[model samples]
Target: MTNIKSQSWCWIEKGEPEKLILKDQTVRQLEEQEVLIENSYIGLNPVDWKLISSGGANWKKNHIPGVDGAGIVIKTGNKMKHIQLGTRVCYHADLNKNGSFSTHTITNGKNIIYIPEKVSDSTAAAFPCPCLTAWQSFKKVPDVVNKKVLVSGAGGSVGYFLTQLLIDAGAQVYVTSSKKHHQKFLKMGVLNAVDYNLTDWKNVLLQSINHNSFDIIFDTVSGIHATGLMNMISYYGHMVAIQDRVKENTLPAFTTCISLHEIALGAFHTYASDAQIADLMIQGEKLLNDIGNSKFNLRDLNISDFEQLPRHLAELKNNNSEIKYVIKV
Candidate 1:
């Protein structure tokens, strides 16, 4: 294998996006189960900026700070020979490892997903984190057919995917998001789309549902805001939190018999067993193929050049805009 030099955005210190520095470094040799990819697009997420703000214990000086990317494989280690060179692929990088903000990145073979012919590099790059989190959250409660479901924060990426998946699975989906997204959610088969800006939006939604409790509530906006949503769930119903879970003290009495679940996709890298990791890959491939087949719609994307990453990330952190960001490398 040849050593290739890569231009990467490095986290020089603990701070916001402004602290990131552009640097040139040599891509090191891959391990037996790793493959080297030349990145074409890097996807940005809130977690990227959040991690930068609160530097982790595992972080080192000049560490790369991105998680999602789509690229072409240039080389594979001996054990990963089955992944052909030049194959188009996308991956969510392990949080503890140097990531995809570079022109090249090395990733474990099992963590990569082959991009379908119909999917674009930008979509593939942006798919893994939010989409995977949505998929995992969807799996938390299985039987949604004809069930009453609510997706809080439905305008966000994860909420978008979860809303679509639940609707397509035959659930009567309801959502709370900005007024601008209401019509779009309605077009996607949502039963009701409540504008969350209202003072008593939850009451507005309750009236829409005729005061009936939801069978399942997928909360993308968590913390106390999510805890306040507990009363809307039916006894014995399920709640899946994508951001932060409700605290134990905030939960209703055990007689309510509610089930709670939390999604942390990045934790899979450090905590999952080999079999679980393989299953995650399988699920990721299925989601990618579903996108290629037009089973799910892509959101509006804000594409920018590599050099604009820091500026875009800062905007993402401060504005909390609905548009997804993809950096072309």
Candidate 2:
């Protein structure tokens, strides 16, 4: 119902940056359930690159690559009564239209969650996927109070937010990351921030929590890399992975013996009842506000060079963690 324009980000096919398929396309006209968003700040999730480069989410056909972002509503469907025009909201993109990577995106109004007046757009961008994952995982298996929860790759955006959520709920959260984020992890309230560099990781964690015992593991990093931590989990302790499910571990029983929850934010979008997700978002917004007022550590975001977006996506795959990148459109 409003004017449309060019989008942000170009997906490449064969070479890293050779193909730009999403280069030309008119945005979708709004349907009754759809609302158009003017993307303010898009949160770069690891999947954005994986789905585009590896064709994991098949963006070659769909084109744009992003899932989470914060923005304002420039237009609303005629039937859309809940969110008014000019409202600020954060959304989990359909993955059909990519996330909010574009200057404009037409999304299902149901997927758009409004941000509180006190929360900044960038902070709202940081909340959706990670916060939803944290809510669903803990909500799925609720009985782990005072139980030790280990969040591997805890320094990442998702892990960082998840750690804060767990801590606020009184769960003993153990975290791991490169030495660089060790101090950063401790400041976020993790019981132990294990640096994968020095000493035996499992031994160090076990030694540190000798009396407490690790009962639940919240893994954001998986595959063979995190086998040692999987081995450290206590009997009947549950392990939920935010990244991918563990196929095999050195301690197969430890991984398989206990409860394993495959926590995917997409599941909520596809399968959750409206009432369930509503409660989560309501709670997520509250937790997001408590985390802090600042968006993320990406205050001095470098968006001047739009040409760097492709390189940024490549770097995201090669590196272990993410570098928060914002491109002003």
Candidate 3:
């Protein structure tokens, strides 16, 4: 008989990662079009902590502690292709379901993408969620030549890459993050950085020539407080959010015409064609290569805990400054 056993991490109902309701649990068998992957690294995302402290309670029961992981393909169903058995790969599993916080996980082969040899495990692991989100979000933006792009919350994983990509694309980049990150962000290529903690960030931004003057604003954290960037948007500007907040707490009144969007990118998994996905993968491959080459600020890093995933999640959720968190299986 098959052992039918593996270890994984899961979250509790609105609980902290340390309180970890479930730890080191056995995994189920792989279904068709599914593969059993031995996880090598873990990439932490905002949603992991977001759901824990705040959102997505509907799918709360199966809340595994992670979403991004890199691993070796151990078992593949007969129908799988391209991604061969025993291949080293990285993946962004669907967060709606359980995630990659375990020694082994059963996942659909479609969501899995092969990592380039040049990409380290930590870089590859980091690329899945934030990288993909940034790529998908940028592809949706309109003209890119000389347009002013304002990225609020541009310090986290997705925000970091989004800022880098926008700067690389020739868009004048304006950012909002902690003051301490201002110098680092400028070094990372942001044209300008605003301190969100400042009491008068608006007036501070208004003083700058590019302030209140953006064509596109990508704000990732908009759940609780007003980002104050709403005042900076030019008329007819587009505001895109990975976490658009709209619960009573609204932005200050501004007659400027604005369009808001809450971009999940998960729908891309279902709607994007093979060629489209291939294009995304191609983009992902190149960016990851650049990042791995020290073209940017990312470093080759790893932190491991297989059976102790719950504890790890707690630590990660505590202070998520970096992007990748690999679980040495």
Candidate 4:
């Protein structure tokens, strides 16, 4: 028989090198739309560390701090129509509740999806936060089919997926990554991959793409030459940023008339209406299904045992690792 009781890695105090302790936590009774899951894997993100250090608006005292996980659904709420009791699932937990650091966690049925048999639990766990964020960012852009697009940090998690999605959709996608990964990006079917590290990399991109400006600039590495990047966008083009908020200094000239979107997955979870949230959940599910069909790859994952979450997250804070880390629960 499986254990219903769960152990959670929790934050008891705030700061760098987070004061995390594993505690036996009670699994709450399920609401009509919730499901109880036996977690198998947990994927780490910058937000997990940020919640500990900065204690953002969603951070609660003595709370677990992970958003992405894959698990088996042990119990489904009375009103859940799409999930079954024995199904394997992957999900992004709600900001208002405790997260996926626990052995057992509860999430809304709508937010969870069945993991295909061919996909490993760790890979499934890796998809939720970053892939959903990428999908939302792309949704914000208009008419991407055959449009010229540039993904500034194409080597990162969200950028990796978004670049492929844009490529699959027939967009003329270009990318920027370290020189070492430029060849890999080329094999992924991008129009061109330029080494953003070179001092003259911006000019190199312009020279390679025939001096054509981009219709959309997806800025994943925020504050890295923000003004110069925006200047390369075609007039009336759009820019989507996951991190850096555009300040007056970073904003483009008035004549350029660029459209800017700052996309945050947390904002959608916290602020969207029920209908809108449902739409996002459906869109995310479709993307996951598409990935399961082998149309895209989930690359560069760093796996660790659950016990090493804190240490791994500390390493992630330094921003040196090239891969996203996943914890086996």
Candidate 5:
């Protein structure tokens, strides 16, 4: 074991995303039921930038920011049972704690899952946030077999995983992406791909399904187009969104009997019971195990070495690129 008393971590000095600074900080001893992971790669998510953008007194006091990370376990709390030192694992960091931007992070043993041997460290880093969110979102509609489904923001990481899950379950999955990605979605076996940027894209989507309606709608970009897409959903259908806090006209959904779910991934960790946490851990491990044989289009990631993390995050925030950034720490 390393006699590591401190770790190098990125600290948020200001609320501005570009104002993050790299610094060394003392490591804390783990609590019972917690484990320390030496992060090899950290996955970036919109929440990271959103936190820094607030630049409030709370964040200024505790500057560490990150959520997704994959690494080797170097230490375990005495009460921890299954996990051992030297296990390679990945997890979503608790929102209340110091995050995964550090070289070593402490996470609850129940939250950490083993990374599959077939999956690389970078890929493992990318799985926790998006895959876990997708898994929880799909649980909203428990019976998807042979049903019609739609995934907004299909080009995104969460949408990609959600769509794949729906498709593999025999659902007639449709997606909204750029025209360039239409064929890509088709090749992935989605029923149709609509270019959301077009003025009359709704009509195109309606025609693709021959005016049939979707039974489930998973909107990763919130419900920005929900009002317009409401009429396309079948009566009593379910809708799940990651960004439902945004102001949007969703009255039409009620008229058509659509149930809207606002999914916040943090809530799963924050409010879960002991049994629920154990179930989540099991689900996470199963998802990782299956990814090796899945047809998910997970190639060509946007990656940066530890030194370039700030610049990469700034670029990720400033640009409209669809790539998910992963930091090799």
Candidate 6:
């Protein structure tokens, strides 16, 4: 209902976070189905930096670049009823649009969910990308109860959520991450935790599991690593890849019966039907509710002020640390 000026970090050119510049920009009138949010916190993900490096096809000079945020709905356009002014919410912005890195952002009402009362702004902001991707990836496998599952890169955000979801659903979970995370994973009920830093970690993993193949493999590390994990799948098992999937031609002939799934959560904004989009919000709300109800062991977020976003992003690009970064806007 009211136009506001937002202080935002804008993409000036492609390369790294350093290319972004801070500026005050005017938010225009919202479309009938859109809502205006005053962002309280912004969550960082690898995709943010990756898109910055590529200068996303839809990006222009001074385009705001972020996907995850939580805040209050300051204004709502005429057609919005479910989302009201002053409602606390969180969202994953459409990749092609101006995003959540600003003090304010505009998104369709359907693209966001109400934050549960018990969830903190940082947790809500951090949940959408990795948690939703994990939810979708977990759903790809039919039923996990009593099944043997492996989560590669289990120390990462998506891997962490996926691993917890699998364990909560009664799957016997195995993980491969840094040695520092081994004890944590074990304490969380992981049947085995292999330190991928070891030269023969994969062999160690196999030996620890008694050479038995997994019924499902959730791979957060792709490329040759994903391909290498193929032979470890049981007959008719499923493999969900969060990054690039193994090329079909390169798949071992004996592994032909296994199912391959690829998860690109951002693509949902561009390609999903109305029903699918609705389901996305529903699933997100479920995750939020779960978080509020103590069904998840939330990780402590590494907090930073808004101005430190670029520096944190640069560090994220170069490091594989498990710390989740949230920018207080």
Strongest candidate by lDDT: 1
The best-first sequence of candidates by TM-score reads 1, 6, 5, 4, 2, 3
- For candidate 5, lDDT tens digit of each residue in 98-205? 788878888998888798888888988988888888888888887999988989878777887888888888898999987777787788799889888988877888
lDDT of all the models against the reference? 0.90, 0.68, 0.70, 0.82, 0.78, 0.89
TM-scores for every candidate against the unseen true structure = 0.97, 0.85, 0.84, 0.91, 0.92, 0.97
Clashes of each: 0, 1, 4, 0, 1, 0
lDDT of 4 by residue, 1-329 (tens): 33468899887778874478889867778899888889999988877787788765656667877889998998878898467677988888876688898898888887776787778889889998889888888888878998899999788788888998899888999998887777877888888898888888888899877997898989888755454588888878888887666655355367768887878787766788888888877776677777778888776789999888888888888874356999998
Q: Which stretches of candidate 4 lie over 4 Å from their true place?
A: 1-3, 223-228, 247-254
Q: Is candidate 5 or candidate 6 better by TM-score?
A: 6
Per-candidate Cα RMSD to the true structure, in Å, reads 1.2, 3.3, 3.4, 2.4, 2.4, 1.3
The clash number for model 4 is 0
Show the lowest summed lDDT stretch of 10 residues, model 6.
247-256
Lowest-scoring 10 consecutive residues by lDDT in candidate 3?
Answer: 245-254
Model 4 clashing residue pairs (backbone): none
Report the C-alpha lDDT of model 6 over 1-329, residue by residue, as the tens digit.
Answer: 45588999999888988778999888989889999999999999989999999988978898899999999999888889667689999999998999999999999898998898888898999889989999989999998999999999999888888889999999999999988878888988999999888899889988977988988998998756787888898888888888776666355576548988888899988899989999989889888999999888556689999999999988888886467899999
Which window of ten consecutive residues has the lowest lDDT sum in model 2?
296-305
**Model 5 spans with C-alpha error above 4 angstroms:** 1-9, 55-62, 245-255, 295-299
Q: Model 4: how far is 247 from its true place, Å?
A: 4.6
Q: Report the CA-based lDDT of candidate 1 relative to the real structure.
A: 0.90
Q: Report how far residue 210 has shifted in candidate 2, in Å.
A: 2.6
For candidate 2, give the lDDT of residue 125. 77
Q: lDDT (0-100) at residue 68 of candidate 3? A: 83
Model 6 clash tally, residue pairs: 0
Displacement of residue 94 (Cα, Å) in model 3 is 1.4
